[model samples]
Target chain A: MSGWVKIAGLGPGNEALVTPEVTAALAEATDVVGYIPYVARVAERPGLTLHASDNRVEIDRSQHALRMAAEGKRVVVVSSGDPGVFAMAAAVFEALENGPDTWREIPVEVLPGITAMLAAAARAGAPLGHDFCAINLSDNLKPWAVIEKRLRLVAQADFAMAFYNPRSKSRPEGFVKTLEILRQECEPERLILFARAVSRPDEAIRIATLAEATPDMADMQTVVIVGSSLTRVIDRPIGPIVYTPRSTPE
Target chain B: MSGWVKIAGLGPGNEALVTPEVTAALAEATDVVGYIPYVARVAERPGLTLHASDNRVEIDRSQHALRMAAEGKRVVVVSSGDPGVFAMAAAVFEALENGPDTWREIPVEVLPGITAMLAAAARAGAPLGHDFCAINLSDNLKPWAVIEKRLRLVAQADFAMAFYNPRSKSRPEGFVKTLEILRQECEPERLILFARAVSRPDEAIRIATLAEATPDMADMQTVVIVGSSLTRVIDRPIGPIVYTPRSTPE
Candidate 1:
């Protein structure tokens, strides 16, 4: 049989959010590769094999998946959210670029899924309705200085901001510093949303202001959205809705 | 029956891209409302009514949806991509904020979808794998000055950029000015991907550099992606893959 590799996204921990294209890819795959949690998300079958690796080894994992596909195996690399957003699609391309030219001939496709930022934003009533920037706050691959610089610039641009991998057990102080920067740059009433395990059974959402936001509010599982100056809040008997209007004054 | 409204995203253009959540909403909707084309995507059923409106009347469409839902109808407002991203979710919330307080009691939800940027980025490789910003270039709502200021700051920050509504028949000059600003701010060889009618049968993707790109390359159907300095291109026999790397030097 011919070999092919599909980088697919299982969107934001919700089965309903998985697109039909991604579902078909997983069904036809003989081998699945990804981080431990993501690989565990795929079911085990008679002909299918799952390779679950630890985090921070994306390069190694990409090479392994490429090798399997080059050996005429149908491989699917599963990412938690859209693979193009700080996920496996770029890693696969990076591997293909640095690997043998023969591997480049293999059929490769990146199937999009509902990314975490959009999923989180939808649950919070469209805090990202206006222009926005998505920044991955992990300093593992880059420097914290770069993260700090982008935060300041995004605030200055008045773009709604979505942050991924905000805080982890190893690096808890990063989010604290992030909150401090936002507090200094934005107004005290700037809207902030902390969405945890969105669309999952344990999903929870919290809306707060810059002054009320604390570092402990966000963890690795959380996706934080900071609204622009024009974002509004509506209090209702059911619940409060927060949304950023599409139009802005000149 | 109690009244409710759901603002759902139909994905870029494919039925496969539509989420099961959105499909369920449409299946149970007593009335569906949206732009002419989007409403046409919904299948006809005995108890369902489709309200197709012209462009530039989002507020009117939103208020109509709200009114129907408040009258004890299950209403669904459809948008081409994710409703939270430059779409109807904000419009519905705006209507809710300004309309009668009684309307606020109506149950409302925003269902996310695979946005055009992510869909386009997947079709190309993963040009949005790193830090990225999404900007709507339509001057009909916001000022051209704001769009230019964002382009400059985004280039300065070295974030990959996605431009929606890049060009239309009426506002062709906006894209021309946009290209000029990018040419001045970004390098001549900065990578740009013009993805037209993405995820549709007529989908077309073109990879070009800032110097090689022309304003006519993108129309309203196109979603433009401008890569950061770190973006790379891999040429293969089938096609070229464009992706932004995950890391940058200090």
Candidate 2:
């Protein structure tokens, strides 16, 4: 049998949000590799072997997946949300680029899924309906300065912003600094949405203004969406809908 | 029977990319409303009505969907990609905000799907694996100035950039101006990926440097991805893989 590597996204948390392409890839895979929770999402079929590793060991995980594929094993690298977005696709490619030239012959494909920001935005009524930027707030790999620069520039450009890994136990101060930068660049009344465990049963979405947003509102599971200056709130008998208008006036 | 509306994304032209959540919404929908091509993707079934309208009539279509939903019809407002991302979700919200107060009583849910940018990024490798911004290049709804300003700022920020609606028959000059702005803000060797009809039978993906890119390379169906300064290409005997690294060194 020929070896191949498929980097597939499992979507946010809902099985319903996963694409059929990803499902088919999982079904054909002999080995699945991912972070613990993501690997746990895959079923334990008779022909499949699962490799669940801890976070922050992405390179190690990628090398393992590639080695297995090089050994003629059908490997699927699972990622929550789209693998191409701050996920396993890049890591797998990074490993491939730096690894043996012989590994280049293996077939690789990326299967897209419903990313977190899109899932959160949908649940919150499309605050990202207009132009938007997505940033990973964790400074583990990138400098905080880079994150700060992007935040200020994105706010100046008036793009709705989505932040992943906004807050974690190891780096609790990152999101606080993010909020401070947003407050400096945007108005106090600017809208923000904190969507936690999106598309899952424990999903919680909260809409707040810049003035009312606190650092505690975000955790590792949360996706923080900051609206542009033009975002609006439509109050209904059910609840308020937050959306950025499709058009911006001259 | 009560009425409800579900805003669903059909994914980027592939039946396999469509989420089961969206498929379920379409299955239960008594009426499907969207642009001509998107509506054509839905299968014909008895007791189901498909409202296929021309482009640029988003608000009218949205209002029509909402009205039908208010009148006891299970309506699904379909967008080609994720409804919340430059598609029907905001238009429907805008109509709801401006329409009769009674329209607020209708239950609405936005089901996310694989967006064009993600699908394109997947096919081309992970060009959007790092921080990225998505911009609509069409000047129909927004002013040309806003688009120009965003282009400059996004390049200055060094975020991987994705462009939707890059070129249309009516405004071919928009992409020309975009390429010009990108040339001014970025380096000559910066990479750009033009993915057309992504995830479809006729899908085409081309990777070029900013200096080599031309306005004629894009069309309304294309999603243009411009890589950040840190983006790299892994060349193999088969083809090249483009990806933005997960880390940015201080």
Estimate, for each residue in A1-250, the C-alpha lDDT of model 1 and write its tens digit: 3888999999999889999999989999999999999888898989999999998888888889888998999999999989999899999998999999888888899999889999999988989998999999999888999899889988988999999999999999999999999988999999999999999999999999999999999999999999999998999999999999899898
User: lDDT of all predictions, in order shown?
Assistant: 0.93, 0.94
Chain B only, TM-score of each candidate: 0.99, 0.98
lDDT of 1 by residue, B54-138 (tens): 9899999999999998899999999998999999999999999999989989999999998999999999999999999999999
Instruction: State the displacement of the C-alpha of residue B221, model 2, in Å, after optimal TM-score superposition.
Output: 0.7
lDDT of 1 at A73: 94
Q: What is the TM-score of each candidate against the true structure?
A: 0.98, 0.99
Worst 10 residues of 1 chain A by lDDT: A1-10
Supply candidate 1's per-residue lDDT for B241: 91
Q: Please write out the lDDT profile of model 2 over residues B1-250, one tens digit for every residue.
A: 3999999999999899998888898889899999999999999999999999999899999999999999999999999989998999999999999999999989999999889999999999999999999999989999999999999998999999999999999998999999999989999999999999998999999999999999999999999999999999999988999999999988
- Model 2 alpha-carbon drift over 4 Å, by segment: none
lDDT of 2 at B47: 93
